[model samples]
Target: MSKTILVVDDSSSFRQVVSMALKGAGYDVVEAGDGKDALGKLDGRKINLIVSDVNMPVMDGISFVTAAKQLAAYKFTPVIMLTTESGDDMKAKGKAAGVKAWVVKPFQPPILLDAVAKLILP
Candidate 1:
């Protein structure tokens, strides 16, 4: 079965771009508008990975990841932070919240795919 990836971002266009890349790589993609919405998508489904944006209207990425890690069903799931925030402080917070990888915004699909490959186990 194809691995399922949950992609969370407020921007619809960004999610579409990421979904297109992930789908092209043979992965099933699930999209959410924000962290709260992404949390809803984590309803005991087999989510192999998560790609989230930091600056979102509802529940930011770090808070979302921290909350997600508390769930028994998703405690160990890997997370990748895809955002425009490149500050060390933000990255540090993400790492603390269990983000496995950090990809700055305006990223190429190939680069994002490479990060996904490293975090998303086969």
Candidate 2:
């Protein structure tokens, strides 16, 4: 079965782009406007991976990751932070939150797909 990836970003266009890439790569895509919305969408669903934006209105990616890790259903689900931030402090926070990978914005689809393939739960 194809893996399901939850993509969380405030920008609708970014979500569209990521969703298109994941779908093209034979992965199912679930989109959310922000971290809160992403958490809402994760009700017992088996999400193989998560790709999130760090700077958002509702809940930032790091905060979301911390919250997600506390949940039994998502404790082990890998997260990829897709954002414009590339600072060491932010990356460290993401790592502490259990994020598995980091992808900067304006990214190439092929590269993002490669990261997904490498990190998505089997």
Candidate 3:
């Protein structure tokens, strides 16, 4: 089966772009507008990975990752933070929150895809 990914971000355009990129690479893609919305959509669904962005309203990416990892079903699932913030503090927090990877914004699909492939397939 194809890998299922949940993408959480506030930007409609960013979500569309990331979804298209993942879909084009043959992975199943699901989108959420924010952390709260993403949590609501996780009911009994099988998700192999997550790509999230920081600084969203109604719960940010760090909180989302923390909450996601608390769920018994998603304890070890890979969550990657894709955001514009590149500070050490943010990255450190994401790491502590059980996020497996981090990608800075204005990114190329190929680069992001590479991380996805490695984390999901490796």
Candidate 4:
């Protein structure tokens, strides 16, 4: 079966671009506007990975990763932070929150895809 990846970002355009790339690579994509929305989309569904943006309104990516790690269903699911913030502090926070990989914005689809391939659970 194809893996399912949740793409969480406030920008509709960003979500669209990520979705297109994941779908093209033969993976299923689920989209959410922010951390809260991403949590709502979980609903017992099988998600192999999550790609998120750090800065958002409702809930930020680090906070989302922290919350997601607490959930029994998703504790083991890997997260990739895709955002503009590349600060050491922010990366450290994400690492503490259980994020598996970090990808900066203006990213090439292929590069993100490679990370997804490496992190997505079987």
lDDT values, one for every candidate: 0.94, 0.93, 0.92, 0.94
Every candidate's CA RMSD: 0.7, 0.6, 1.0, 0.6
Ranking the candidates on lDDT from highest down gives 1, 4, 2, 3
Minimum summed lDDT over a 10-residue window in model 4 is located at 61-70
Q: TM-score ranking from best to worst? A: 4, 2, 1, 3
Cα deviation in Å at residue 56, candidate 1?
Answer: 0.4
lDDT (10s digit) by residue, model 2, range 1-122: 99999999999998999999999999999999988998899899999999999999979989899999999999999999999999999999999999989999889999899999999878
> What are the runs in model 1 whose C-alpha is more than 4 Å off?
none
TM-score of 4: 0.98
Please, what is the TM-score per model?
0.98, 0.98, 0.97, 0.98
Candidate 1 lDDT, tens digit per residue, 1-122? 89999999999999999999999999999999999999999999899999999999979999999999999989989999999999999999999999999999999989999989988877
Q: Clashing residue pairs in candidate 2, if any?
A: none
Q: Which stretches of candidate 3 lie above 4 Å from their native place?
A: none
Candidate 4 lDDT over residue span 28-100, tens digit each: 9999999999999888899999999999998998998899888899999999999999999999999999988
Q: How much is the lDDT of residue 105 in candidate 1?
A: 91
Q: What is candidate 2's local distance difference test score? A: 0.93
